[model samples]
Target chain A: MVKLKSNDDKEFEVEEAAVIQSEMIKNMIEDGCATSVIPLPNIDSKTLIKVIEYLNKHINMGKAAETGEEDDLKEFDEQFVNMGWEELFDVIMAANYLNIHELMELCCQSAADRLKNKSVRAVREMLKITNDLTEEEEQEIINDAPWAFEGPEIDDTVN
Target chain B: MEYGLIFLLINNQKLEIPQIILKSHPLQSKIVPKLTYNSNSCKTSSNTSVDKKVEEKSFATAEVATLMAPQIPSNESLPKLPQELITAILVRLPVKSLLQFKSVSKEWFALISSSVNGLIFYRIWFNSLVLWNPSTGKYKQLPDLMPTQMVTTGYCFNYGFGYDEVHNDYKIVALFREIRKHCVGAKIYSLKSDSWRILDDAQGEMLYDGSGKLVNGKLHWVTIVDGGWSIMSIDMVDEKCRKVEQPCYGVDQFSLTLGSVGK
Candidate 1:
């Protein structure tokens, strides 16, 4: 076990093999520099726990690694991202910062899934963003081409 | 997704997608919802500059991959390369790997998409299968075609592809059918145009003899055509698709060599 301190001064214990999945941490360990509590100023405990969970699952399943029936494992990872959108974003941000390649990929693909079947309005709402392009600019972009919305009735959809 | 579908149809030779379909799509970064009929949102943005964007996108990518990635020389191996390097690497990869890598990124989704079609890709055979080109880096999805006895297994299948040296046009042909009725005609794909079109089948010729092979400048396939089975050849150069009759003597009786009869 290794002790780690989060950004908010919370201390947590993580299994050595699991935490080492972070190549960043693995490099630190190989350098013989991780003897004491490793402090992670960038990651919060909430996101760190999730990352640790993933690493742990991966290592524990080193059992069925060869059969490659990792689909069930992949499904669990997918369900893990089924949280509220804000949490997903937080995890994604943390994953990117921590350089957890698998976690980063999972979050990006999840982000892609959210964008899959949404409308422009829903997209804006989901991302909590307003159009940066001006109304005139939006119209100008829409004016030059109209087939994109050629046959849709948006108002009737909600009503 | 309109542009995505257009790019796909362009390869399909489904009438040229109206430019409007491409003009209204948002970037992969910008995701809009499923398209409906009341798309007042889709107007504007004439994509006269689309070709320019494609050229510029290619240039910008090559610039990043070739110009930027190696120059920096970071101490740690970088996780990602410029999109252009990825595309170049993707184009060189076999279809199997590309299919798996397609799940990597949204940009990769757009880049590796089979939606935008123009490159001459694989030819279709019987049984919901298509012959694919690994060279250009795209796989074509052929419509569900009923299979014959010969092509039930993959080994019986063969693909004939080459450049017509006389005309400098490239062609792709796939043949695998047990019976003449089921034998698909040679489907011609041109590199310059990057589209597939059905060539006139060699009329009254059997297409399922030993299988079609590309030798010299013509396509050679065995057919149980005519009253009996015969070897047939098509000269892509002259657009002449005709049958070549087997000689007077049995092929085994003498050392019969296959030769082109005409110029």
Candidate 2:
């Protein structure tokens, strides 16, 4: 078993097989650097819980095809990324810190899919991003592709 | 993280064009060099110009980075992702979405444009061609082909871009056919000389009209030879077209398309 401590001073126990899926932790284990509880300063307890759930479910991923559980794993992944923007961002950061390749791809792809049809205003609002471009600069970008900026297909609702 | 290594044989000898590993993870720094600009030959005038432009642009990046540093959210508010994490998300978006999202912010505008590796050869219309490098903010408009304006209802035009290792130049190959006159022609444009020439010795009829795939110092295409589709490659060195052995796919009903992966 491997013990992981989140930034909120919460510690959780996980199986070695499951935790080893994280390349960062795996490397530490290989180098005898993970003797005690592994500290994750960047991830909070809530996000760490979510990541642990993912790692547990994705354990023995190579044997999933043989066991006919590939569809189950796929469905779990589909449901996993169906999170709010803020929550998804947390998961992405956690995945990056842990160096979990599949989770990072899943979260990033979900984020991209959500932002695919969103208008610039909707995107800024959803992510709470402050647009630092001057009006003239913004106008220049719009002028280059005026049709792209004002299309009916562009989604305006912030999800 | 799956690593891929693709091997190619050129002139009956192994030729490895640098390892093109796609390190998309935010933590790992991407090491893949841009194939559009080979870094080895720094003495070339165009190469030196590109280096100067990149240096200037990187200086601008540092200022932008400092300007963006404070805007990042701390512990209280919604956690804002780091710049690299944002880049990981943006790279997966479609081009249409990227175009719309360019107005999101100044950083987004720069990120979307500068994500391109090097030169992007794009065709606006049938006749007009453009080569743009977003990082350097440089663009060049190629001379419009008069024959493209002559494209009628039934005729088609195919174009391809690739690097010629032997001459150390970039080349754009264009194949066009005029149905009314029953004439087929091919043209090659060299970036070194900034000129175009019609290939007099090119067997345009046998050479299929399609986008050429650059692999191992050659541009490959599917050709119709004796009523059967066969693989044909054009040597970048001599500009000579030669037949290549096609992959043995047991089923003849499958359609064939040429594509190149890695740098």
Candidate 3:
């Protein structure tokens, strides 16, 4: 078993096979730094739990594909990332810090999917990003490519 | 004991005790950094003022224990990720979303504009010409040269599309002859400015065969003048129309097609 200690001091006992999904943890284990509990100062307990759940579920990914469980794994992944924006952001950061390639790809794809076809205002509100451009600068950008803004697929209102 | 068991059940079912309690834990307080947008700086400052507020708020409610709810981090807690992470996410986004979100920040605007690599030319509805970038899926349509009146009047016009490397622009050259006046005229449409302008010096009695070839930043067309075929070339850079002498073929009396034998 591999022990992971969250920033909150909460300790999680995870299987070595499951925990090794994280490249950072795998490297630490190889270098003998994982003799004790691996400290993850960048991730909180709640986020760490979510990441552990993902690692556990995806541990047998290769066997799942051979046994035709790929669809089930894909479905689990789809439901796994169904989180609020703040929660999703935490997961993305945690995945990045852990160097979990698949989790990073999945979370980034989720972020991109949420942003697809959304208007400038909606994207700003969704991401909680403040638009710092001046009115003239904004207008100039709009004028430079007015056709991009004319498509019917664009959603102007914030959800 | 029965009442205590019921309370534990309620807490487990409704609040998920471990998750909620973890929020108030001391080490968890430092997990997320504070994000502040400064107008003058136009950048996010890592000053821990907002982080301190979160720590104090979480710690102040720690004594309440079971009664305290899980603290959902505010939007400002969204990590100010590194540039590479932001790029990874942005690159996966569709072109339309990228274009619309260009106004989100100066950095995003620069990223999207700089990532545009190539242009694709296509025609829509057989008449509307467009310049598109397949990688980005962003396209701009060129203005229509033939108006409704010209179409209804059944006037014939020849067109050639070529690029002007000097100005970094695409241009469409049109050659036409007035039916009643028998006067030939030429006009050029610039994709950069999205406008058309007539070439003032393009006045002649030349008869074009309605086909044009674009080569070497110029438009070439075969025209018959005084019962003989000659090559007419338009210099897109200078917007001038001039005739080129055809090679001697011993007066063989045959039609010629204008083509470029690659240099």
Which portions of model 1 show Cα errors greater than 4 Å? A67-69, A150-159, B1-263
TM-score of each model, in listed order: 0.38, 0.51, 0.49
Ranking by DockQ: 2, 3, 1
- Candidate structures ordered by TM-score, highest first: 2, 3, 1
| lDDT (Cα, tens digit) per residue for candidate 2, span B6-25 | 11111111211222222222
TM-score of 3: 0.49
DockQ of candidate 1 is 0.03
**What docking class should model 2 receive?**
acceptable
The CA lDDT of each predicted structure is 0.44, 0.59, 0.58
Q: Write the per-residue lDDT of candidate 1 for residues A58-131, one digit (tens) a residue.
A: 77666656778588788889778887665666676555444455675666556655554344455445544434
lDDT of 2 at A7: 90
Q: Which candidate comes out best when scored by DockQ?
A: 2
Q: Which ten residues in a row have the lowest lDDT in candidate 1 chain A?
A: A150-159
Error of 1 at B149 (Å): 46
Which candidate's TM-score is highest?
2
**Model 3 stretches with alpha carbons more than 4 Å out:** A157-159, B1-77, B114-263
Ten-residue stretch with the least lDDT total in model 2 chain A: A142-151
Worst 10 residues of 1 chain B by lDDT: B38-47
